[model samples]
Each structure stands twice: as structure tokens, then as C-alpha cells.
Target: MTNPIVNLFAFLSLLLFVHCDGSDPAIPEDHRFYETMMVDGRARTYLLNLPPDYYKTNEDLPLVIGLHGTGGNAGQFERDYGLTEKANSAGFIVVYPEGIRSNGVLGVRTWNAGRCCDFAMKNNIDDVLFIRTLIDKLVSTFRVDAKRVYVTGMSNGGMMAYRLACEMPEKIAAIAAVSSTMVVASPCHPSRPVPVLHMHSVLDAKVPYNGGKGIGGYYFPPVDSVLGAWSAANGCAVRDEIRNDDDRFKLTEWLNCTDDVMIQYYLTRDGGHAWPGGQRSGNWGDTPSTVINATDLLWEFFKQFEAQ
Candidate 1:
């Protein structure tokens, strides 16, 4: 299992990312491509970035799907989340699934993500099924390792990632939720235990870390309560540990969980309702945390597990 080539590959990948400026994660194109598929009579779209030298390999690669917040599209998430470049350097396939433009409140693109978002939520969009079907297709076409499939997203998209892990635990190996908390209705009965890594900012007002309504006067459940539910579901020990990293961010972990699953959170003191260690949401979004790059943390967490 100890391969020098693999270790060197990982080292070079990290080196490439360290040299990148968090504010600008976009890389030159050629390997990035978009694809559309019909799900439930509606045309769903997604953008994907393949790893460098992808064509030369017969190996099955891990797949990571990044979802954007409300008012964001595949391209925005692809850029803002800073996952595409990671995909290229880290040798994993990355996909950005687009949300539908809503006709209801907000009147903008959003994921249903259970009962927590606009448009998609109001209309009862089958985003869960759409994502499931998309995963199936992508896995078949790209030789993806189904057990290594992972999901990460921001805001509403992060909530959607929670929904997927809750409803389709069999398909998702793990999930990393950013700047968002679990808003899915109670009784989040997953078929099996799911590993979850949540990252948020203490200063995030859009989705406050302590809970209550945030942006657009939307109600958000307490982040601790949400994590508590997941830990309890995973049969993790009651006690949790919290560690401070030079006053920049606090790391909390539930050490003993059933199935050797990991349940942890990274609450950064810097940054607001935006991704930590990446560019702001858009031109007018909040500044990202300089203490840590979320993309780096997400991948590090994701690489540790596969579907159990």
C-alpha cells in the first residue's frame, strides 16, 4: 500500500495548490466540460473538470460534486468553491450541478435541499432524485469509483448535500458541508452511518453558527443541534472534543462513532457567510477566511473514506 509514486503525486498536488491564490482559483481550460441530462422531464445541467492526464489512465477515479449557493450556477460554484483546480491537481473528477431558476419567492436559482430553500423547496423539486440519477450516469461514463463518491457545497447547496447524505446514504461515501447547516426535516433516516465534515464561520450571518433566521429572513436550525442529531444517529459517544488552532479556527470532533465514521466541524473565527480559504461568493460576497482554505480541508476529509 506504500507507493512512492502515489505519495509523490499527492505532494506535488498539494504544492500546486499552495502556490495558488485563494482569491483566484480558476485555471486554464481544455479538460473542463459541461453536460446536460433529462431528469423528471426537466433538463438538468452540470459542469465537470477532469484531472490532468485523465485520458491516459484506465484507473477509476474518485468523484466530487460541488454545489453552489442560491443565485449561483454551475460555473460560479465551479469557480468560487475552488474545487475544479483541486480536481485537476488531485486527480479526481469534480462536478457542479446547476439549480433551477425559481418562480416562487427569491425568484432565483436554488436547490430544493429539503424544506430550507426557495423556488426548489416551494415547488417540491425532486433535486434528490436528480442528483442520484446524475451520479449514476457520471459513474458509468467516467469509470468513477462508486464507493469513493463525495459531495461538498456552499449555502443552499450545502444543505442539499445534507439531504443527499440523509436520503441516499448508499451512494455517497461522505459529505463536507460549508457555510450551511442541516435543515432537512426531522427523522433523517439514512440506511447506514454517513461521515460528515461541516465547516462554517463564527461570523457567518447568512447561516448563523448558533442558529436562527439568516439571509432573506430564512430560519436555520442551530448548527450544534444538527451535528448532535447526526452524531446520535451514528451512535457516536456523547462526549466531543474541541481544539483551538492559534485562535483562527476551532476544531471539534466526535471521536468514537459507530463504523469508524468521522464526525467533525471546523468553525473559523475569520470570514462570514462565505467559503473559507476561497474567493468571496461573488464580487460583493464576504471575505473568505485566511486561516484555512476550505477546498484543502474538504479534500483531506473526503479522501479518508468510502461508502460503508
Candidate 2:
């Protein structure tokens, strides 16, 4: 029989854990109102931007969800990637979601993108559900095209994007991950074929182009392996058609997939763990590549698919 004192202690420990897990710092209200929603009894926050013509037009706009790297936030991602400006010109809504903070702090944030992250993984946060719930809210609150929802991210956020594509293909039409790869050990089984676009640099020191353990002992798959797995999963042609876009960039495509789905890979000869053709903002160690503008390329790639 369980001792009454032990049972009481166990109950108190559970209460403390719940309280600590649910505690989160207040979100700052910059130009973009830091929006929050309760997910799994914890407060999740994201920044939503509508296109300039959104209020005037009745057309359903595409929704792009951007995830940031470890130790990054939604506002920093918006500023660094300059995605909001692109969304304004392209007529789409961009949502930048904040990752779970370490000890409820503002900056030091991380996503539970699988095996190789910090606090989020340690605490076993349900980031997938948080994103799904956020998408549901955005779809209903704004004029979001149910068929054109997309996801993208940098580093850990990029890994999270891959996880989303693997797990939530029904809701996410396509994904464009930068400086990230699939780190989950379990086999990915998407409900439907999901178009994928991967951008990486051969010189990435943080997450190596070849598979290896990275900072914080995070094991990352090689770029080739990730592309190969997705191609097979999407039933694309076994032979990848490759093209040299420029001296520093190579484009590889896996064609003839089920339901017209395609997997694309962009390889930059240089630029280590940085967003290709993005602004250098903070100390995220992202060396912007001049070979191609990632935002333009990803948007072009993403426009080809719509959720079925």
C-alpha cells in the first residue's frame, strides 16, 4: 500500500510542475502586437502580419508561418528575414511564432524540433499542437486560404518545419526549411504528399552538410539523406535532376512525384549556417549568401503547391 505522506508529496510535486510549466513572461507589444493563446495549458505567442491590401480585398490570402532558430524570437525573425516586406508585396499573411522560452525569459527560446534542442526538448513541449492551434485561429480570424498554408524556418525552426511537414501534411501544403534537417528518429508518415524545398550551404559549420553531431550534441542528418528520404516518401523519380544555377549555387529537383508533388534542394557553395540572401541582423551566425535570395526562391517554390 502507498503511504499517505508519499501520496501527498507526489500530489504537491505534480502541482508545482504544472505551475512552473504554465508560467510564461508577458509578451512585449512592439509595432506588431505579440499575440498569445493557451495551448496545453501554457501560453503560446506569435506575431501576425496582414498584407496591406488585406482590409480592402475579399480575396483569400496565403498564410506563411515562419519559425526562428534556437535563442531567437518572432520579432527578431521578422526583422532578420524581412519576410513581412515580402508578404506586403506578395499579398500574403506571415505569422512568426515564438518558441518556448527557457525559464520564461524573453530571448533564450527553443523549439522541440526533435532530439537536438535545449529546454523545449528537455521539457517535452508540444510545439506541433501549439502551431496547429495557432493556424486554426489565424485561418478563422483572417481571410486565410485553407489550401495555401505554408511553413518555413531557420535552424531549429527549420527542423520544426520538417517535423510539421512529416506530421501535419493535411494542414500544411508545403514547407521550405533553411539551415535545418530531419532529426527525428521515428519514421515519418504524412497523411498526404507534401512538397518540400530545402536550402543549405555546404560550408555550414553549425549543422554540417554531411551528417554529424552539432552544437549541444544535436545529431543532424546530411542534406543528401534528408532530400533522398523526402523524395522517396513523395514517390518522386529516383534519379534527381540537377542544375547549376550559378558558380556558387546548385539546384536539384526530384520530379514526377505522386499528385504532382516535388522535392527541391538548393545548395550554396559557401555561407555557413546562414539564411541565403538574408540581412545580417543579430549574432545568429548567419552569413548571408549573395548567390540567391532565399525569400524570393522559397516563395516561388511554395506557390506551386496547395493543400489537397
Candidate 3:
């Protein structure tokens, strides 16, 4: 007779494979589908949100891709950032792309945003290529305005935004990074000048304002250095203006760049390692600031530019 214990173990292994087959479940009519793609032999997933008017009109609309931070998933980012509601009101499409998970769980995801971070970086995953492919897929599948594609992200995701701006400037019109700095060592050379906005908090302990090694041995360049590099690359002038300065928040703009590409920075007095005016997504260490709504401000900034 055959060994009963061995047969039971084999049956359980088959069950586990079925459970982890990477298929999406049925999504609600109001909610977007959790889509998956095969990139470099790895399965990648992302959530897409279309505006209420998407089906109502044939007009081409702008697309914004939002990247999640390390140890954060696309679902959590979409829920916490509240961009879908904003997209409905503003008439744009929004996408939240999930990063590779180190532990194959929702809470341990990380992007290969260059030299920093965990599994994605160690494995040398080409995240920039993946994002470019995602953009192409969305543009062809939806009524995406080719001249109005933009990107924004939080922490590690923010760093990925900068990487996209550097490598895919022709595709991305602008980028907004919150609580993140450029971690790449070499100078960034974009095909064209791209508008950029950075938001940070003075009290952020994780990615220090001045920059250094952060948690998990991730070395972050100083925020100023990050902005300075972009400014120089974009040929921005010395013209700098401070807007919306108060006890809570200060906005600085570097004007007169090539193609009118403005580089802006927002410094919040508080809100350590958090998206300004966003909900704290449990134990993520994001202390939202009350000074400014990042989604509103970034959308306004993004609307000012189109791909040249």
C-alpha cells in the first residue's frame, strides 16, 4: 500500500499552488480591478481607477501613476491617499502600482528605486522599465492623453518617481515626490526638461531632511542636493520665490527653467515621514500634516505641464 502521509502532503502542496496562482478575484462595479502583468518572469500587479466621466465621454484625459512606499501595497496606497475621489472630481485617471514584496505579503513591498531599499534593489529589478510598460499599456487601452502623463509617490515610491523622470522624461511630463530624495549617485540627464515638485517634513526622522543612512541601511542624499541636481539639469535660473509661507508650511519655487519646467519644494513644519494632509495608514509611521493637502497641490502643479 502507498504511504498515506506522503499522499496527504502532496495534496496540500497542490492546494497551496492553486491559492497562489496570481489570479485576481471578482471586483465590484464601483471598484477598479486588481490587474497583473508578467514582467521579466515576475508577476507584477497594479490598481487602476477611472473617473466617473471615463465612460461618459470620448475625451482624452490625463493619467497619474502613484507609487507606494516600502512595506506598503497598492491597495493601502490607494485607500490612504484618496486620489480616486480627487480623480473623479478633477477628470483624470489614477493608477497605484504595487511594488515587489520581500515576504510575498501586502505590508512588506519595496521598489527598486536605485541604490536604496530591499529585495527589489538587491535583485536588480528594472522598475523604470516596468513603469514605462505600464504607461504604454494604459495609454493604448484607455483614453489617455499622451501629452499629460504624470507620476507621484511616497518615500521609496517617491524616489522611483525621480528615477522615472531621469530615465523616461520623454514619456513623463512631470513628477511629484513626497518625503523622498534622489538616491542615485550619477547625474540625471533627461531627454527634455521635466517639471518636478518635492514635499518633505522637517521632523522626518526616517529620511532625514539633511540626509544620510536611514532605517535598514538605506542612504538618502540631502533634499537640497536632490533639488539642486534637478535644477541644474533643467537649466533653472536663480529666481526663487516663497509662497504659502506660514507657521505650518513653506513653498519654494525655482523659476525660469528650460521649457518652463519649474522645480518646486514644500517644507512642512511637522508630519514626520508622512504624506502632507493624508490619513495615517496604520503603523506605517506616516504622521499626516494638517498644513496642506498633497494630492490637491500636486494635481495643480501637474496640470501646468504637458509632454513636449
Candidate 4:
């Protein structure tokens, strides 16, 4: 033999390299990866975070689509929203979808949530289709549980979440909106009753709690109006029912709805337009509430329902 020991050493070295390089051969071999798809003949980009042991098993994990607020990009939202860490711990996959950029800025972007946004709204960008197609693409590319797809966002992104629920209820199992309200002028209608969870702070300057012009100069309807619309669309017996209460926050819900769907809202006395228990966006960003971990609550809510 030329060199049997050397050959064994080389083989071991090759295995080490393969282990370090993640030789899974999956479309996304890394835990945190990127993928691009075409929607409306336009290139759309998204960042994906898979659970740490994702490639270790053949599990079909649930997917959570996180949308950024106005003037935000996917990376920034991913960093500040605290979803990736939650995904790792909860054994779910989370993706942050980038919105179309505004003309004046490089990274600043907005979503076409129906109305009251900047570039995307003015151009009437097809964000709804983008998200719907994104879900389909994820299902095609990854081992995602199609029936357990959930969506969540903040501010403008949250409004976009509302829009998606209104337009494509069948594709989504449930939705949770934070610091957002339905700004779509069209009447609410869905193919089926979709479960909803909403969280807000009474003191939020942007997306004001009682309805009025926000710090972004966008006019909003009262929270009651938003809940009323959702309740009626889901065929709830009542608009709001007090479920729980605390000094820092109050829990309201709509339980008696068609198909047993439920709607829950959390109004916190503290905090502003920020993700509850997430890192504050910036030095000047609103302080998130400390009472509840939204990531945990949303996952708890999301795990209960599936698309039927």
C-alpha cells in the first residue's frame, strides 16, 4: 500500500470538512439562509431562519412570515423583532420578507397594504400575491407544514398582515398583528373564518390606540371599529368579551364565532409602537412592554389552529 495511515487521516479530514461545511445538500443547507423568488415579474427577496436541528431530521416545521414596518427592511426587522431566537427555541422556521423600496432611499421600504403607505401603496404593488406566492414557494422548497402557516408584523407590516388575512384566508392558518390596524377601505370578507390575535399599547403614538392621525400622519379608525369589522367578518356573537385583565394589560376576545375561530386582542397600558418583549428598534424607538412575551404568546396561539 502506498500509505494506509495517510489515507485514513485524509478520510477523517474530509469528514471533518464536510461536517463543518454543512453538506446537507438541501436548498437551504444552513440554519440562517436567503432565498429569492419572482412575483409579478419582480424579484422578491426574503431571509429565512431554520431551527438549529432543522437539517438533522425530516420534520415538517411550521412557518412564520414576519413583515417589516414602513421604512424598514427585512434584515433590520429580523434583528430587532426577536423572532429568530424564538424560532430556534420553539422549533419553527421564521422568514422575514422584504418589501419594495421607496424611490428616495436605499434600504427604506414599504408595503402595499391597501392604503396609507408610501411607495408600495402609491404604486399599488401586489404584496398580497407576493406573500401568497412566497408561502407556496416555501412549501415547494422546504419541508413546511402548509396547513400551519402563520403571519405577523409590526406597524405598517401589521397592516399588511391584516390585508393578507382579508384577501387570502385559505392560505393562512392564523394571523397575529402587533401595533397595527386594518387600513383597507374595502369591506371585510374572507373565504373562511380565520383566527386572529392582535396586540397594541394604549400609549402608542404611531397607530394611535383611540384612532386619529398617527405620528406618521396616517389617519386610523378606532380599535373598536377594527375589532367590530373582524368580529362581523368571523360571524362572532359579540364584538369583544373580557377574558383577563391586569394593571399593565387587558385581554379581550371574540370566542363565539363561526367555525370556532377566535379573535384575541391585548391592549397594554405601557409601551408604544414596539414589539412586546422584543429589543427596542433603536435608541429612539419605542420601548417594548415587559409584561408579555409576544413571541411565546403568538406561538401558543398559532399552534392551536390548522388550515382545513
Best by TM-score: 3
TM-score of 4: 0.88
- The segments of candidate 1 whose C-alpha lies over 4 angstroms from its true place after superposition are 1-30, 104-107
For model 3, the superposed segments whose C-alpha errors exceed 4 Å read 1-26, 103-107
How do all models score by TM-score? Answer: 0.88, 0.88, 0.88, 0.88
- Residue 193 lDDT, candidate 4, scale 0-100: 89
Q: How well does candidate 1 score on lDDT at residue 154?
A: 86
The sequence of per-residue lDDT tens digits that candidate 1 reaches over residues 1-308 is 77888755533332111121222134457677677789998988888788987889899999999987877777767666678788888999998888876653433567888766766888889999999999999888887999999999888889999999999999999999998988886569888988999999999877889999776556899888888888888888844678656578888887678788878899999988788888765445778888988899989999989897
Candidates 2 and 3 compared by lDDT, better number: 3
Least lDDT summed over 10 consecutive residues: which range in candidate 1?
A: 15-24
Instruction: Flag the better candidate by TM-score, 2 or 3.
Output: 3
Model 2 regions more than 4 Å off: 1-32, 104-107
Backbone clashes per model, in order?
0, 0, 0, 0
lDDT of each: 0.80, 0.80, 0.81, 0.80
| lDDT value for model 1 | 0.80
Residue lDDT tens for model 3, 223-258: 988888888889998645777788888888888999
